[model samples]
Target: MVNKVTVESLTYEQLAKVFDHAILKPEQTTQDVITGCELAKKYDAKSVCVKPCDVKQASDLLSGSRVLVGTVISFPHGNSPTAAKIAEALQTVADGAIELDVVLNIGHLKSGRVQACQDEIKAVIDACHAKNPDVVFKIIFENAYLTKEEIVQACQLSVAAGAHFVKTSTGFASSGATLDDIALMRANVPDHIEVKASGGIKTLDQVVDLLNQGATRCGSSGTDKILDEFKQRRGL
Candidate 1:
């Protein structure tokens, strides 16, 4: 669905339709997460994604609001073990995160440890589900490390492993989400799955472009700037 964004305040109907939104910083203090929630609440954002370390505070600040708490697991490198990743996801959720982003096993996947990578993803998903069956699972593939073929294969694998979304990057890779990567994921994912275009999505135009390419969500720290543009554009 094309995001019908305007400068006016967002609604539950509108927020559910929102896929692109803000992520908190690791260096930011608890006050920052509170501030982020206040700002996101003003727009009724779908979620305020923060690093795992901040999930507890963000969740507390955003409690009673419609916004969900998002946290990343395993992160950009994907060198962490399946057990460690599951543990991280468990900790994140226990800390009040409702949406989990797990990094795919890139080294394993690239080295033809296909089943290993798939099993890792599945384990994370299962563990997260066990904790909170309602928790949403986004599997980051760090797409810049992949070729087009790898991106497609990863998308299929993510779907097969029961991930809710196929994410592009951790925003720490050499490159972030690309139209090509989102397009590939959109094309390859099963009907039940979604695509989240993360990393390096700084501008409103870039976010719109990602949505056009079938990105259902976006993770970025530049959300304030984007909202500013939206306000300016709509003269609200």
Candidate 2:
């Protein structure tokens, strides 16, 4: 974990490491993905979170770099069958994705299918681990569509399922990551299970604020703007 407890104490490199440069939009073209990968490389981002189809390309582009490749499973909607989700997790890993952000079954959770939800998450993570033990797994709660209690429940489910992180929002929802949501998620999960703030994170301030509030990662498409602002703020 990052030892820099406060945002002011964080260096430019540390701030860059907190970002997972996102390129997950459905309409993004192949060229857009290439440009996004270049941006991630330029910023030394921790990872490039791309769509499933783009996983191989991203992995290939970032092969010699430290920027890892990550892809989403079940995506904006978490309504896929457990078997399909597991297949996607396996395929993405095979395509060189080192991290997987899986969307939780929002309907199941809201409808009180707690055991089913936890079971699916466990099955997917277990299968992915079987393929690659070092592949990181994150559970997306899509908090914009859930109640506070539901968010807490999702956190518990993620922990029970042994997820490495609990994420907020999918960026296709009505709203995205909020400070209140980050704080709430931080309080609900254990120290080992970190929080990730995604969806609508566009500025350096938002990034720093979320990290200070306990989010170890922030997903954003605005890598250039955020990192440029960081340099400007410090006159670098």
Best by lDDT: 2
lDDT of 1: 0.79
**Candidate 2: count of backbone clashes, pairs at least 3 residues apart or interchain:** 0
lDDT of 2 by residue, 1-236 (tens): 44635545778888898889999888998898899999999999999999999999999988899899999999989999999999988999999999899999999999999989999999999999987899999899999999999999999999999899999988899899999999999999999998999999998888878887889999999988999998888877
Scanning candidate 2 in windows of ten residues, the lowest lDDT window is 1-10
Cα error, candidate 1, residue 110 (Å) = 0.9
Candidate 2: regions farther than 4 A off = 1-7
lDDT for model 2: 0.92
